[model samples]
Target: MNLILKLIAGIVAGILVGLYVPLTGVELLYTVKEIIGQLLTFTIPLIILFFIASGIAGLPKGSNHLLGKTVGFAYGSTIIAGTLAFMLVSAIIPLFDGGLTFNAEVATPLSNLINLKIPPLMDVMTALASAFIFGIGISQLQLETLKKVSDQGRDIIDALLAKVIIPALPFYIAGVFAEMTVAGTVFETLQTFGVVLVAALVMHWLWLSVLYISTGVLLKRNPIELIKNMLPAYFTALGTMSSAATIPISLRASKANDVQEDVANFSVPLCATIHLSGSTITIVTCAMAVMFLSPSMDVPSLVDMLPFIMMLGVVMIAAPGAPGGAVMSALGLLTSMLGFNDSAVALMIALYLAQDSFGTACNVTGDGVIALWVDRFSKKAGS
Candidate 1:
């Protein structure tokens, strides 16, 4: 919540500076944005490699079937949520406005004082592939040494995100808006930001309804009661803005929803890592909005968007615990798959961070749904 407030302050400060301050001042902000942007690019692949490798390799052994079921369920939910968001946002955004075009005549060009370049050790796809290979090998072969290494790498990256990147985001975002304000397009962009945020929030609840109702019908349980039991976890996530941090409440809530104690213990923690349907929805929605608002990009067709959605589900498995981690994790996909430029990516970060807590709340609440399903499936198999 403090993070959200700080981000709001950043946006307001940037807009004020752009409107009133000298070009030199706004250039300073732009320089900060450039430096932060380059740093983000450098760390994205490392975040993907270490977090995904650690997540996969650290899966509890001796529960192979349960592990498979949990992962399958989590991935499926994420993909479906992302695809659904694309469909809904695509259909709706076009009805309101075709696109938001920047006024080149009114736009003021800003330059960074320092052009620093920091390259990543590997590209996003290579990191993903390497992580999967090493992760599966470590898990299947019981390689404790490599597993420890991956875990340590994950810790290092996690600290980098939590301490450095997350703290710097507000200034990074301020720089983005400051540039937009100078370009005279900030107000138009702000209008679209509000609409897209509302749309994303509505879709979050809508997807939650779909998940719990479907789970209830399949298991012959009261969906409302189950959802009611999960409300504490939902509210907790809104405060923590992290699924992992909300796991304790989620565990109690899942048990209240009648998920077996053992299953809740296993699935809640695992789902915190892998089940990110809510984050996927926000990312997909925000990505589409950024495309519509950017002249350099176009809103993708269903065929084009499907591949991104699929990749998004996989990439989300690597999202760190930092605020706005989902957007950070998906940055590689946005750039490589969707061709998001720096300005577009900056808009995505701003839009996503605005409603990060709501999305996280949905993520943790939906974990209970997964817990219930896994419990039922495991019970039937045992019987």
Candidate 2:
């Protein structure tokens, strides 16, 4: 049973249940969604703290300088991907502007079956801060013990993914869509943002092509061959909708393309955190669609978005490489800076989740391209 297929099954099953199955007296099903969302929330801070810290810390001290160049290229590509999606979605959305409204029903909050308390790491700033502190600190000191500890921290998260989260995703996804169906927001969101989604997928591919085509030319490797070899990673990301989850697949693909193990190791994990080309595309496009639909808000001009997109490009560096991570990163900005109401934020969530897989596919595939460029630069310097 392919994991992707199983997840797809969960999505389909959930939609069927949400639409056809009676929601009467089905409190347990609703709880399933809540727990999974909580688990994802729990997973984000730890993964960010550990994955970033360990990834940066693991690099050799002299090699640490490469971080600057790597981040530059990664951020540059992410902005390009976001801008492309923003332009394409902006152009296409007016055609679908039949003025769809989100008629979300008021729903009761589900009560917890059991009271359980975990101390919160709710501050993303704290996570980002700790990641940089521990990562840079360990790199400078080269503390073997601390490296081992950080590795263990990442291992613990992996256990959570394999044992708890991964196995539970189908149910989680089903529960999510099912809840959306009950709330009556999913279909309407889809109706309005379908064009945005198509635009996002198209941009995801275009940006990926831009990356590989450039790297392919630089390395003198056939770009088509590079892309063909990465199909496994792409499909894996598409199914998982998570760059962190697809790291192994992306690394494997990079190695197959002759990326040095050191580069692949350092690049893939770091890229998972910072290389969010696909996710940004979806976020920008979805945010624009939500604003346009809401009537009170109009989408910002590209000039207005310059600073915001620059900030978004940086903020995404701290974004967890998990499903829905990009939107969560954008949530604060959209609400505070962009004046999005609760309804608009909710629409953004639904819209981003709906197209999360494609964005993730774009993200993980792009990781391989970055690895190629990094690998080439490393060899050039070594020579």
Where is model 1 more than 4 Å wrong at Cα? 98-108
Residue 53 lDDT, candidate 2, scale 0-100: 83
Stretches of candidate 2 above 4 Å error?
A: 1-24, 64-67, 99-119, 190-196, 212-274, 286-361, 364-383
lDDT of 1 by residue, 275-296 (tens): 9999999999988877765666
- Against the reference, the lDDT scores of all candidates come to 0.89, 0.72
The sequence of per-residue lDDT tens digits that candidate 2 reaches over residues 46-134 is 76677668767875455554676568778888888777777776787777676565433325343546454444475555776788899
Estimate the TM-score of every prediction.
Answer: 0.96, 0.70
Candidate 1: the clashing residue pairs are: none
